[model samples]
Target: MNVLITGASAGFGKALAERLVANGHRVIGCARRLDKLNALADTLGEAFLPVVMDVSDTASIPQIITDLPDNFKQIDVLVNNAGLALGTEPAQNASLDDWMRMTDTNIKGLMAVTHAVLPAMVARDSGYIINVGSIAGSWPYFGGNVYGATKAFVKQFSLNLRADLIGTQVRVTNLEPGNVAGTEFSNVRYHGDDDKAAKVYDGFKTMTGDDIGDILLWLIESPAHININRLEVMPVAQTYNGLTIAKQDS
Candidate 1:
């Protein structure tokens, strides 16, 4: 199988790419950082093809897909993993630029890539799409703001896409993960504040990127007739926060 993973230079995408390539599947790894992708290419060897692509650039995605080498062109699996959160501030205090950037990459980019890839899958009547979503989409939290909204869009879009692809063999899944550690996720969220990022998982046992990779491998390798629609994962240390209220003397 040929797999195309976005944000493949780091975190979950990188881990998934490694897992797929090691299992004898060809992988097309796409990301904005050429140096990081190239370094990964060196490590993963010829089985992993590193392609420089910014998913947020909606106009360029189709062209990139069209330009792939022969062996990697027919993408049997598409993992929409390019996304991030910026500014852990209340909506009233968040930056507009941060909101727009998150919207561009998380919503528009995912839509563009899916629009570009789904047709071929429908035509072939065989494909799998794994969308890397977040638990924040289903359960809101303080300072989640636009990031949470974007992932909610992902969750709904995946379900709707599944509805639309009912006749075809094409499958869509929304994988919602919670509180993963050992990735640039926190650093990026905290805008390079290493101490702040480190504190998020300082003592808890958080899920690693490799764990997600393993889950993805299983999902893709499952029987063609079976489709796991949504898989929400959280570490043992995490759980739903439930409701919160402030009490005062009457």
Candidate 2:
């Protein structure tokens, strides 16, 4: 399959891209970091194609979409993994720029890529879309604020897209992962405050990027007649709900 993954420079996107290529799938990766992407392409050889794109730039996306090579133009899978959480602060105290960044990437950018790809998928009637969301979409928390709201949009949008393509063979799947380790998420959220970011998964084992990547691969490789709509994965260190952390550190 010819696959397209955004935010493919690191974390889950990079993991997924590597795995797919290893399994003989051609992958086109887009991110703001051309240097890192080129590095990945070098490792994967012809299986990996790098496209420099910023999801937040509305003007640049359409042209990039059209410029895909003939082989990649008929993309069989699209992974909307290019998103971030900025500043773990309540809305009232949060920076407007942070909130806007989240909305732009998580909502507008998602829509832009989907709009550019879905039409072709619908016409082909044989493609899959995997949206990488967060458990925060369903269960909000302190400081989740706008990041949570954006993911909520992702959840509902995935469901609605599925409804709209009722008769078509196009499939939409949402993967909401919790407390993933080995990613740039915390760093981005804490705005490079390494100490605070490091504490997020300090005491416990967390899910790895490859774990989520593997789950996604399973969802796509399943029979065309079967559509796995949603899957939520959480690390074992954290149990159900608010039970996991109930301590006072004064």
Candidate 3:
């Protein structure tokens, strides 16, 4: 199968691209960092095609896909994995810039890629769309804010795609994960504050990018007749702490 994964420079995207190419599937790895993508290509061989892309820049997406090598143009699987959380501050205190950036990359970017690729998949009547959402979409947290909202859009958009493609063989799956470690996620969210990023998972056995890649492999290999609507996963050590209320100071 030919797979196209966004944000392939790091985190879940890079891991997934590595796993897929290793398993004999061709991968077109898309990201803004040419050096990193080129480095990955050197290791993955000719099966990996690295395309420079910024998912947040929706306007450039069409040309990027159009300019792909002949053999890589027909994408069998499209993974919307390009997204980030900009700030940990409460909504009222958060930067407007952060909110807009989250919206652009997480929501608009996903849509642009899907729009570009879905038609071909529909024409072929076969394809799989794996969207990397987050548990934050379903369960609000202290500072999830706009990041969570964007993921909620992903969840809903995926379901609506499933609905619209009811009679077709195309499948859409939203993979939501919680508390993943060994990725640039925290560092990016904390804006390069490694100390603060380290503290989030310092005491926990969090899931890794490879673990998420394992799940992606399964979803891609599932029977054509099956469409796994949504799968939410987290480490065994992770769970809800229940709701809370704060009383006024005495």
Once model 1 is optimally superposed onto the true structure by TM-score, how far is the C-alpha of residue 142 displaced, in angstroms?
Answer: 0.2
The best-first sequence of candidates by lDDT reads 1, 3, 2
Q: Kindly list the per-residue Cα lDDT of model 1 for residues 2-77, writing each as its tens digit.
A: 9999999999999998899889998999999999999999999999999999989999999999999998899999
Misplaced by over 4 Å in model 3 are none
Sliding window of 10 residues with minimal summed lDDT for model 2: 238-247
Overlapping backbone residue pairs in candidate 3 total 0
lDDT of 2 by residue, 50-127 (tens): 999999997788899999888788889999999999997777899999999999999999999999899988888889
lDDT to native, each model: 0.94, 0.91, 0.94
Measured by C-alpha RMSD in angstroms, how accurate is candidate 3? 0.8
Q: Which residue segments of model 1 deviate by more than 4 Å?
A: none
How many Å off is the CA of 71 in candidate 2?
2.0
TM-score of each: 0.98, 0.95, 0.98
- In lDDT terms, how accurate is model 3? 0.94
Instruction: Tell me the lDDT of model 1 at 42.
Output: 93
**N/CA/C clash count, model 1:** 0
